[model samples]
Target: MPARADFPYYDGRPVPITGRGWILLMLSVAGAFAALITIPAETFPATLVPASLFAGIPLLALAHLTKRHWTALFGPVGLKQVGQMFLFGILAIIASLAAGVTVYLLGSVAPNPAVAGMGAMSGTAFVLRLIPTIPQLLGEEILSILPFLAFLWLATTHLRLGRTTGIGVAIVSSSLLFAAAHLPTYDWHWVQSFGVIGTARVVLTLAYIWTRNLWVSTGAHVINDWSEFSFTFAASHVPIGTR
Candidate 1:
């Protein structure tokens, strides 16, 4: 195994978890997906249980692989990282808006039923769902970044791609997988899922690429979704004739 300068949490090695370690990592990822699909609960606090497992399983595997230094997955969340969050969050919002408009022009966009439910929730219930979303979103960041680095390693090492080309391959492959994961959520509408959600993932993944810190991307994801959630809630209450 060789060390590279791009991905973090690998102690500078691109493929830190080689041999048996990589297999364990894949198992954890599979286990996380299993928890997500098989868990019976669909609402609030109970939903948090599966979310925890989704993030915890791979993280614990990383912890063992990294010799208890898995905390490196998160760089310091100081003011700098907070600033990065807002910066990248805005970029992601812009990217999504552009992609959304394109998708809308090309074809109809399917609405997320979950967001539709947001308009009807009580204030407390809204906040309850919002609270769980933060951790769940962190799980999403994990789902994206870990595989990204894996693909990066594969491209560079096995495929012998130059670093730049390898990174491009990783980005496209990881974004495609992220988009595919949302197919069920978006009513199997490949156009909207790949157009909007996949486009946004590229911007969010840039946060990690720029800083090598998962927390920065997680914060950006929270800012992007939270702002959208808040706006949707507010807009839902607008008077019928106001538009």
Candidate 2:
């Protein structure tokens, strides 16, 4: 068996999920789902603050209960890692865009209306909106990464799956959940949610799996989201029909 150090993200050890822990994990997932479903679009930029807390607290507790180290999860990012993360983050964004374009060309999906609407916001409003995204993105990282580690632990320890098999399952399942969590934002569009967002999540998860550092993945996420927001903001300022 490989030493626990080989998988520091999973606490460098396999701790079986107790029945109570399972219950808590389920409750956390449910709470996050409920919070996402109820968040109103009209109050968005502001409501995101409370919604982040509502959705994040449970997953934060799960991380603690699972004995995940803070250092391993949110460790410092070196200068070199920052450059590497940006490169990976841009690649992830390109992959998502390519997927969306391919789907659109095939007439399998339409452009996401919510995304189109983002291009209508004034620059000031858009900048204000982007501010709160700092916490929101961090909260999202907790939502996705913690559950991913939990699922991985369960799959490898309880299900007797091989490490590679467990990782594959965990990545796909958690990425799906991450995509589903964006349903409210995407107005429940399956193509935008599962096709675009989910594909981006797979790339982000791969970053985490490779570095075993949440900060790396989170940095990549910030870059991806910020790039999108910037593009929309610029588009909003441009005169209509002026390419």
Candidate 3:
């Protein structure tokens, strides 16, 4: 595995992003959340607008900061990478299952309102909602991977930590951030957020750490969530008390 902050845009760049750049990137993410609330998402299709901004703004800031090298962050998306996407996506789901079990044993697992909301949705409505997930999941992956890389840079460069140590710290820190982002989604359930969601993040992040490609990790994320959504939709249509 590449070490010493081999993250795209953070490495081999014309000008490396500085602390100020990190602040701007985070601010762009904050602005995205602002846009999400300011805009109406009552309709399923209307969600595309906010989801697009959520994915676009931080990505645009990253490209601008790195001299318009957006491709570097996306990396290659060939057959091999697609295979990795499915592979890591399965792994993430399994990890979340185990984490959910453990958390349930400890206390309770919070239900996801989004998945529950799909129970009433028609096939057409489900597809419409699925459309928004493309950008929404991309935005979710960007939010996680960017911070993972940033913390890796901080640990290796400033903290003078070893490569493995830096990666571990980065994964934990970024996972916490990912979990925190989902606080509202899980109805502010800290246990579920930090336990189940955070655990899934650890594996999804590894997809990126291994490939240095955001697309791979993002694809894995999409697979994981899409599978859940599909399951929810299918179950909703299944006749109750029937095999």
Candidate 4:
């Protein structure tokens, strides 16, 4: 058996989640998804405050019960780590854009409706819209990373899978779920959601798996989203030239 120190984000603690813990996790994820889809857009920003609380508080409590420190789950943040995260974020942005463009060129994806709408907005309006995304993106990481770790735990412990097999299962399954979660936003387009966004999730999930730091993955996600948003904003604002 490997020592606890061998794990990413290890702080020499046992991170156990009981069957009841899994139940609570499922409930929290379901509730958050429900709130996201049901809430009125006019009041959506306000809803996220409570939705995030609902989704996050229980998971935090589970981490405490498991005797894992915050640093163990999220990894410690410092100036150096932040700089590293920024670089990883840039990598994530480039990878996602490359995937998206490739898929688009292959006719595997249509123009994304959400991005198209954003491109119709003025630059200032786009910036205003992006403000809420910061917190929302963090919340999304909480949703994604917690389940990822939990699934990895269950796979290795209960299923008796090999470490590499377990990690592969956890990454692919969680990333697919993450991609499926975006279906409503993508107008239920499988090509866009699964093909494009799903590939991006795999990249982001690998970042977390490699660094074992939520901050690194979150930084990557934030940069990826912001880069896409900036591109759309610029396209909207730029004057088209014709000879």
Candidate 5:
């Protein structure tokens, strides 16, 4: 087992990354695809699912490398911090809902303006789409966060950098990687997705700045994800042509 002493400790307590040092990374990502495969094979689009699957790999690698599966991915969080994170997440959701609603309303004025295109799908199909979204928020957050946190761990452990510097580097690196992961398909939707992701990254960074604990930041991330998922799901359900 790796020593907790060797792990980064922003609050003077070491973070652990043992059982999931490597394998958890693979499984979380694979689990995402496994969820995707649940969609009737033919119903799954080749374009989007592949990106989701690809996006999951980094988190998997982070989990495996750190040897801590969930914490590395989710940020070594605790219950109190979870509550705080939930609060921030609620704010994020409100912001996203406001933005989505604004977009919809703004579209009403333009000729053939765009919006989230869920109305095109049948009810059953829309429900099926929800399956991937659920796992995606949960799974991808795990994958997205772990490696960056792991990198923070490595910097603190090996480089003996200050907590702030270590965390700052981790946030920037993670966000950049998150953005880069979307490089292959730099379309409007992808840009929009990365923008949401980047904003979440900034929020997580704020949590780290305030608490200096991996747990708080991780919780913030999960909350952001939950917020995005809940809002996007609801937004998708709204009549596309209505707004």
Candidate 6:
């Protein structure tokens, strides 16, 4: 329903988006999700964390294989980009920790808040807990990103969208796609809950700007996903219903 001319990334340069290209991207993403999330978690397969590695490694490979503009599609990844990534990662973690601690302290003072999923562990074991978290992150992020990039590339090649506008358009359009897709899965009202997904997309966009590459954004995305997975793994929770 969205028009190629609608994005800010549109330039006079020609970009193309054929039906075949879109269908392939969709099939690839769907196959990835089924393989990584649905199938492995199923009773028939019963494997642990195959989805993450499968999705993560393959997406990176695909990006490289296409040899497209990495900065526009993913974000940025280089030596300097790595440094910025670590800085942002550390800052995000610290902010999350501080917010969580503050919430706990406030709850302790109020009506004795419900003690949810928080506990302690040895440092080594605690760090190791992230092993279980990578797949979902890889699956979802790749699914969200790849299609948009493909579309944007097509638009550029066919419609003549400029590089800068193409990136901007992809970021905004991808954010919308991500939020809409999550509405059904999360069982939340799309109009109300889309802001959260949009915010995450903004962070990803910032990562793209910070490094002018996709690799750093992917790395940052992986790191962000690890944080979420660490807690879920620690709590023994499988959010996708533990198929």
Name the TM-score of candidate 4: 0.82
Model 5: per-residue lDDT, tens digit, 184-225? Answer: 433434444345445555565555555545556545565665
Mind giving the per-residue lDDT tens digits that candidate 6 earns over 1-243? 953232212221123334564565566676665565455352212334556644655455454434352223444346887887666555545544554455456543221011122224444544444444445555656666665665576657666888677667777777787667656554454433355445565566566555545566656676665666465545654344654
For model 2, what is the C-alpha lDDT against the true structure?
0.73
Candidate 3 ranges beyond 4 A from true positions: 1-5, 11-14
Residue clash pairs of candidate 1: none
- Give the winner by lDDT: 3
Tens digit per residue, CA lDDT, model 3, 1-243: 755446664443645778788778878877876776578886766889998998998888888887666666677789999999999999999999898998889986678988999988998888999999899888988888888878877887789998789889989999999899889888898999999999999999999988888899999999999999999889889998783
Candidate 2 residue lDDT tens string, 1-243? 963244543434444456567567667766765665566645546657555765476657667665654344555689977986897699889989998897677656555454577787876667766766676676677677767877787788778888899899889989998898877676677877888889999998888877767778878988998898788768768777896
> How much is 229 displaced in model 6, in angstroms?
5.8
Error of 4 at 212 (Å): 1.8
Local distance difference test scores for all models: 0.83, 0.73, 0.85, 0.70, 0.52, 0.53
Model 2 ranges off by over 4 Å? 1-5, 8-19, 36-45, 63-71, 108-114, 239-242
Better of 2 and 6 by lDDT: 2
Better of 4 and 6 by TM-score: 4
Model 6 / residue 230 / CA error / Å: 5.9
Taking every candidate in turn, the Cα RMSD to the unseen true structure, in Å, is 3.3, 3.5, 2.3, 3.7, 7.8, 9.7
Question: Each candidate's TM vs. the true structure?
Answer: 0.91, 0.82, 0.93, 0.82, 0.52, 0.57
Which candidate gets the maximum TM-score versus the true structure?
A: 3
Displacement of residue 53 (Cα, Å) in model 6 is 6.7
The C-alpha stretches of model 1 lying farther than 4 A from their native spots are: 1-5, 9-15, 239-243
> Considering lDDT, which of the candidate structures 1 and 2 is the better prediction for this target?
1
For model 3 the TM-score comes to 0.93
* Candidate 3 local lDDT, residue 103: 86
